[model samples]
Target: MKQEKGAEGFSENYWLENYADVDDMDGMYNARDHAHYLKAVFALDQIAIRSIADFGFGPGHLFSAALDTFKPYRSLGLEPSASAFIKAQTVLKRYQPQLLQTDLASWCRDSSQHKRFDLGICTSVLQYLNDQELAAVIPTLALRVKYLYLTVPTAAEQQRFVEEYQFVDQYAYSRTRQQYRELLSPHFTVVSSRLLESKQFYNDQTSDFTEDLFRF
Candidate 1:
C-alpha cells in the first residue's frame, strides 16, 4: 500500500461497521438516486463503454447497476474500507473474479499492472474528501480515464450537511462547477454538466436533494 497522510488513522472495519448502520451513516446526502443513474446508463449507447471504474464504490450499488445495464467489457471497483469492499465483493460477484481492490492513488501510480480506464465514475465520494485529498486524487483519476462521471453535493445542501452532521474534515468541503472544471481541465475535456434536482423519495414526505452531475 502506498503511504498516505494518516493512511492508518482509520481502520477499514470501523467504516464497515459504522456504515452498516444506516442511521449512523450520512444517509440524506446520498449521490444520484439508483433509478436516475440507471436511466442515464440506459440512454448511453452500449457500444460506447468497454471498461469502467468506480472509485469509492460504496455498497456496490452503482457498480451493480453498471454491470447489469452496460455489460461493459470489464468493470473495476476501488474502495478504501475493508468492510465496504467485502460487501461490494459479495454484491458484485458476477464481476468479482476480475475485481481489483486497492487505493486509487497507489494504483494509479503503478502503470505496469494497473492501466488507465476508458470510463471512470465517482459518485457522492469526492465531496467527502478534503481539498488536499481531492487535489491528489482527482487529477490522477482524470489522467486514468478518458471519460469521467462525478456527482457532487449542491453548495447550500453540502454546507447544511457539514454543519448538521458535525463531520471533522471529510464532508465539510464542497466545490463549485467551475472549480471542478479547473481541476479536471488539465487532464480531460469537460464533456457536459447538468444540475439534477435529485429527489429522494423517502416515504414521499421525506424527500431531499442530492446534487449535480458533471460528465467529463
Candidate 2:
C-alpha cells in the first residue's frame, strides 16, 4: 500500500539497518561523497546560498552537512517516513532547520515560501515518485529553485550498484538518464554530475560553471 502511494519503503529500521558511517553500506546520505564534492562547485561559483530545501534527507547526514557547509539562512528538510524522520532528528539537533514528515506533494501544498531557494537537494528522491508526481515536481522545482542537486539511478547503473556497490532500493523507478532528461529539459538544464540549473538560473551564453562535460 505504501509503495502504491509512491514506493516509499523507508522506516527507522530501514535507515538504521541500511546506513552507516555517513555514506557507507546501503547508500544513505544520498551518497555523501557526492554531496561533499558540491562544496567545491558552490565555492567555484561563489554562490552565497541563502535558502535550501532537502527532499528525502535520509538519516540527516547531507542536510546536516549542508547546514554547516553552506550555512543557509533558511532551510527545510522533508522525509516521507515518519519513523526515519524521528530517528534522523537526533542528528539535526544543533540546527533549527524546519522539518516535515511528509512527502513532496504534501510539502508542496503547504509551503508558503514564495521566494525561490538558492539551492535545493533532492538526491536519491525522484525515482520513488510515480509518473504523476514526477510530472508535477519537475516544473514546480524549476519555479522554486536556482540550482538543484539530484540523483536517480538508471537501470543499468542499478545493476552495477547491486553487484558491486552494496546498494539496495526496490522502490526506484526503472529509467535511463536520457528518459529522465526528457522530463527535465523543459524546466531545467541538466548540468554535470547529477547537478541541474533551473531555467530560472540557466543562461544560454554562460559556461561559467564547471567545465567537465556531462556523460551518461
Candidate 3:
C-alpha cells in the first residue's frame, strides 16, 4: 500500500511553531459558520442523516458538530494533518468515529469497506485537489452518499482573493462553480447553492424544486 500524505502545511511542526495561530487555512476557523451549515442540513429535514462521511475533517470541529446534531450511530472522518488527526481523536472521542490519516483519493479507493452513507460533507477541501483528482472524486463521492454538502472557492472568489490576498491559501486552486456543478450534476441534483441530493437514493416528491435552473 502507498503511504498517505498529510495536509500541505499542517504537519506537527506547524502546530508546535505556530500553536496560537488557529487560522491554519486563512479563515477556516469559525464555529458560527459551522452552525449555519448545520442549520441548512437540519432544515432539509427531508433526509435522515444516520451515517456521515467527512472526507477532510481537518481537526474534526465540523465533524463533531455533525455528530452532535445527527447523533448518528456510524461516522467516519479523514484528516491528513498529523496534528489535526491527533486533535480530532480527542475532539471526536465521545462519538468514537472511525478516523483516518489519509487523503480523499486514498479513502475513495478503499471506501467499499462500509455500505453507503446518508450524508457526506466536504467543505473547502475540494479546491485543494488537482483537476483529475477532483473529477475522479466527484463521481466516487456521488456514489458513496445519499446527500452532500460541499463548498469550493470558484474562479470569481479566486479573482477577489488576487485583488485582496487575505483569503488566499497558496495550496489551493481556483476552479469554477460551473466546472464543479457540471461534474456533480451527472450524479446528484442541486438541492441548493451548497447542497446536493443524490439521484441514486433521493426520491422526494413534495419538494418545491423544479431545478430548471440551479443557483450558485
Query: How many residue pairs collide in each prediction?
Result: 0, 0, 0
Per-residue lDDT tens digits of candidate 1, residues 1-216? 212232222365445433544543432233335424544653553325577778777678666776665677776887765666777787788765255556656555666745656667776666556566667876667556655666667566666655997533342355776786576555554434432111111111331222223333
After aligning candidate 3 to the native by TM-score, how far in Å is the CA of 109 from where it should be? 1.2
TM-scores, each model vs. reference = 0.64, 0.82, 0.79
Model 2: lowest-lDDT 10 consecutive positions: 1-10
| lDDT agreement with native, every candidate | 0.56, 0.73, 0.71
C-alpha RMSD by candidate, in order: 9.7, 3.4, 4.5
Rank by TM-score (best first): 2, 3, 1
Flag the better candidate by lDDT, 2 or 3. Answer: 2
Off by over 4 Å in 3: 1-46, 165-167, 203-216
Give the Å shift of residue 128 in candidate 2: 0.8
| Sequence-dependent TM-score of model 3 | 0.79
Q: Residues 77-163, candidate 2, lDDT per residue (tens digit)?
A: 888887768877998778888898788866666568576788889877787887788888788888888888887777788888789
* lDDT, residue 97, model 2: 89
Estimate the lDDT of model 1. Answer: 0.56
lDDT tens per residue, model 3, 28-74:
46644664666655565544568988888876777787788778889
Q: Give stretches of model 2 more than 4 Å off.
A: 1-35, 165-168, 205-216
| lDDT, candidate 2, at 42 | 70
Better by lDDT, candidate 3 or 1: 3
